[model samples]
Target: MSGRAENMIQLIDVSKEYKMADSCRVALQHINLTISEGEYIGILGLNQSGKSTLARLLNGLLKPTTGQVLINGMATDSPQEIRQIRQLLGMVFQNPDNQLICPVVEEEIAFGPENLGLPPEEVNKRVDWALELVGMQEMRYHAPHLLSGGQKQKVALASVLAMQPRYLVLDEPTSMLDPLSRREILEHLCRINQENHITIILISHHPEDLLDAKRLILLHEGSIYMQGTPKEVFKDMEKLKAIGLKRPGLYQLIQQVEEEGYRIDDNIKTIPQLVEMICRI
Candidate 1:
């Protein structure tokens, strides 16, 4: 589905700096970006490359040291506007254990709307909807701590969804889960973006997780090194390796096959596509 053409989030010349005891470190430097409504964007970078810093800036968790972060035309730098900005942006972190607060799954999902002083009826409606959206309706009474890592992440996601934010910023939300769980979370995110019309900003290191994104942004040393579609970005294996990122195994294998003087389609992404190319050869 195509996102609304207008900019939903804008970062204009944004930079973030942290002041240590004796020195100041720049986490992001003069970064400018625009995210349209309902867009699915993946952010990739090595450790300390400012991925998390960028996420925080989008949600008003951290103010930019120099530039402005605008959420739907509202500036996040204003203290009074931070709350409003946060209501429009929801953030899911890497660890679900740290984010889930309530004991039961249902309460955890309702916590956000309850804090907003929503009526009990509205809160229940939101809780029910969020639970169903994440496919955790059966686990409403389950203890979050006892659930598997993937289930816990889903609950955490439900909590964020209950808030009904226009934008969702995920900071490596699946890093702790197993591969199956990671895929589940990513699939749910895609559904959320497409069906729910929520803009998704996913920060992940896994190439597979980024394949479905409409755009991919690569960060290096606090700057945007490259930004493009997954096919466009991953085409340059040497550049990805230089940035401490690896090409998908399938892509690497395709490269090797090409080197052996075999003709293969470079644009192929899925296994079936590869199989068809091999059969044709």
Candidate 2:
């Protein structure tokens, strides 16, 4: 798919600083960005980088120390603006346990719309649609505690979807999940973005997490390191390694093309895609 959509988020020269006991910490600097609706985006960085800080800024959880953060053309700091923007932007944190407060699946999904004082019928309709969208319809009555990590994440996704948010911000949603659960969550996110027309802004360290995103934005200390398609970002293997990121194992095969001195287009991004590309060559 083309890496373009309706512009849903815009951060104009945004900066953030936090005051500590003796000193101030600079979390981010002059970061400007725009997110389009239905576009799958990944933010990659090492631990303690400004990835989470940016996520918070998106939903107005933290105000920028300088510059402006705009959502759907309105500045985020205005109380009236934020209240309206927040309804269109929903966030999911690293742990599903923290986000899931209700005991049952249906109630959790209905919580957001219910708070808006939506009619009971409308709320129920949204809950049912969100549950089925995340493939959790069968488990609607199941207790949240009984769900596996992957299932819980799906329910978390359902909760966000239930709010009918146009944009979804996930701050390392799969960080605590097992490999299987991680894949499951990632797959659901891909399907959600594609089928539901929901914009996705994800922050993660895992390269696998970038698989479904059309573009990857690398953040260091508090700056944009690079931004491009996954294949474009992975092309510079040494640059990625220098920044504490690694390309997939298939990247080794791609590098071999240079060793053999061939000018072939080895822009394959995924292992399966790489295998097929090589076989076709």
Q: Report per-prediction Cα RMSD to one decimal.
A: 3.7, 3.7
lDDT of 2 by residue, 217-260 (tens): 98988989888987677779878878878776665666776567
The lDDT for every candidate, in the order shown, is: 0.89, 0.85
Candidate 1 Cα outliers beyond 4 Å, as residue runs: 1-7, 253-269, 276-281
Per-residue C-alpha lDDT of model 1 across residues 1-281, encoded as one tens digit per residue:
13313348988899999999999999999998998888999999888999999999897879899988888888888888789888899999999999988889999999999999999999999999999889999999999999999999999999999999999999999999999999899889989999999999999877777777889999999999999988678778888878778877776667677778987654576767877888888
Write down the lDDT that model 2 would get: 0.85
Highest lDDT model number: 1
Q: Flag regions of model 2 displaced more than 4 Å.
A: 1-6, 257-269
TM-score of 2: 0.92
Estimated TM-score per prediction? Answer: 0.91, 0.92
